[model samples]
Target: MAENVVIEINNLAKYFPITSGLFFKKKVAEVKAVDGVSFAIHRGETLGLVGESGCGKTTVGKCVLQLYRATSGEVIFEGKNLCDLNENQLRPLRRKLQVVFQDPYDSLNPRFTAADIIGEPLQINSDIRGSDFDRRIAELLDIVGLAPYMADRYPHEFSGGQRQRLGVARALALQPEFIVCDEPLSALDVSIQAQIINLLDDLQDKFGIAYLFISHDLSVVRHMSDRVGVMYLGKMMELSERDEIYKSPLHPYTQALLSAVPIPDPAVEEKRKVIVLKGEVPSPINPPSGCVFHPRCPKAFDDCSKLIPQLKDAGSGHEVACLLYKTSWP
Candidate 1:
């Protein structure tokens, strides 16, 4: 796995400044969107990051994509720390690190036709123009399950699923090594969701593209990811192989999250016990001391409120952050 790693993140953290006063605004506090989170994505492997809304799943993706500069920590991609590079230094690497946002329409320009939208990346990054550009556009559309004829149509003219396909095509235009899928299925219908999932799966198989798949949907993550990492309040609760984590979650937070996902079988669903967490998520500006999840964690101990646990491996590459486990990890 070490040799196969395409990207490595070490103690990654992103803190958004919170200020007061409109004109003379000054940094008062910070929203710790990502705090000391660390993980790696292997070549052609999809790493799923799942969490409740505002728990920093998207922030982690942004940090990996270098869309959001980290306050501290390393995001090593292509042998350089992305957070350390300026826009000029990072421009050449942009094509290799593409992203497919949650909202298809919002991420795309309504004024531009589908052809122009997909061709924009090519137009700026590549010297391919005229007939060559046209052929590339058609090829990309076909690759994403869209017809070449639909290239001339506007985003509004296409259905939701088609627009998403269009988004996927644009991401593929650069033939990137890695792609950040930021809740790409959240805005689509359930039926449409499956199509997109399969499309992404097929694309990865064909191109060997690594993906940092961020979503709130547990089932989709389970299906798409080789490994899954569960996050809560800007900290990772657990990380493991998909089957192992789902079958035997070490963290209480992970247990709660998996319990919430409904089983398809009636007999299994009827017998399954749902873990209903208590209280609402605390504010990021004033997060609780020690373990951020202790407030809602059912198995939280007295030390959980005073001692923050670092992610420690609990055998076979499964890592968890909880005071209940007495282990050391570096």
Candidate 2:
């Protein structure tokens, strides 16, 4: 592990196997949801993951949280490989890693009151209980900008934004050092999204927690992340510093993705030429032979279909898995 690195992943891969015959199932084909995707989340820094739907961005977050076991490779957190740890070993470490899932309504338990939902983690993981737990729950609600009075309300009683605040409150209850904020803003109103974003920023500043913020919204990712990683069909197309990724995208897929986001200013938006790809994203079960984005790439050549491009340092820590950046294609 390097200095200030909270978590490091190397060639992480996850496959969901398809089966036939209900009684005696036989393996058919597997969905390569996440294949050879690697990146690091530093202490107190957010690493934004952006891609089209079914591009394995969410799977990456789940795998890091150990919600979904990786089929291969390593997930090193705080110098220990999480992939090697079994359920018993992972139970204790679970306190240090938490998740704020997409769809606040779907993630929360509708039957449980806000207090129950937030206090559940503490009851399971810590000794704080009764009045101490109550006090902690109140503090958590305050941390996420929720009133203590609202703790008695059910998930259905609160607004979408308030429910999301409840989810955040629960995640913070354990005081985890790292969080997997999976599309935390996608389900909320635009104005509400701003509130949640600011709350996350304030939480990070106060607690020095790292985040793996996953979403399809490029603008939100740009605002929250220190560095961004682009994935396409389970492969990381590009990874670079936030500003560099936006100003100068190296991968063709990355360029196309960024171009699609509308600029705020009409003058710039009118002048900008959006790079539209030709075909739909390929299925993960049967991906392309080589570069996953080759079928839709504007700059793809014959070699792109023949060789798998490894992510290499283009310059200034900008890693791109595009053959265009290589000297000699073999």
Q: Write the per-residue lDDT of candidate 1 for residues 1-330, one digit (tens) a residue.
A: 378888899999889999999899999999988899999999899999999999999999888888888889998987898889999999999999999999999999999999999999998999999999999999999999999999999999999999999999999999999999999999999999999999999999999999999999999999999999999888888999999998999999999989999999999999999999999989888889888898999998788878888898988899998877786322
Per-model C-alpha lDDT, please?
A: 0.92, 0.93
TM-score of each: 0.98, 0.98
Residue 92's lDDT in candidate 1: 95
Q: What digit string (tens of lDDT, one per residue) describes model 2 on residues 1-330?
A: 789999999999999999999899999999999999999989899999999999999999999999999999899987789999999999999999999988989999999999999999999999998899999999999999988999899999999999999999999999999999999999999999999999999999999999999999999999999999999999898999999999999888989998999999999999989888997998999999878788888888898889999998988899999899882233
Off by over 4 Å in 2: 327-330
Q: List the residue pairs that clash in candidate 1.
A: none
Best prediction by lDDT: 2
How far off is residue 40 in model 2, in Å?
0.6
* Reference-based lDDT, residue 111, model 1: 99
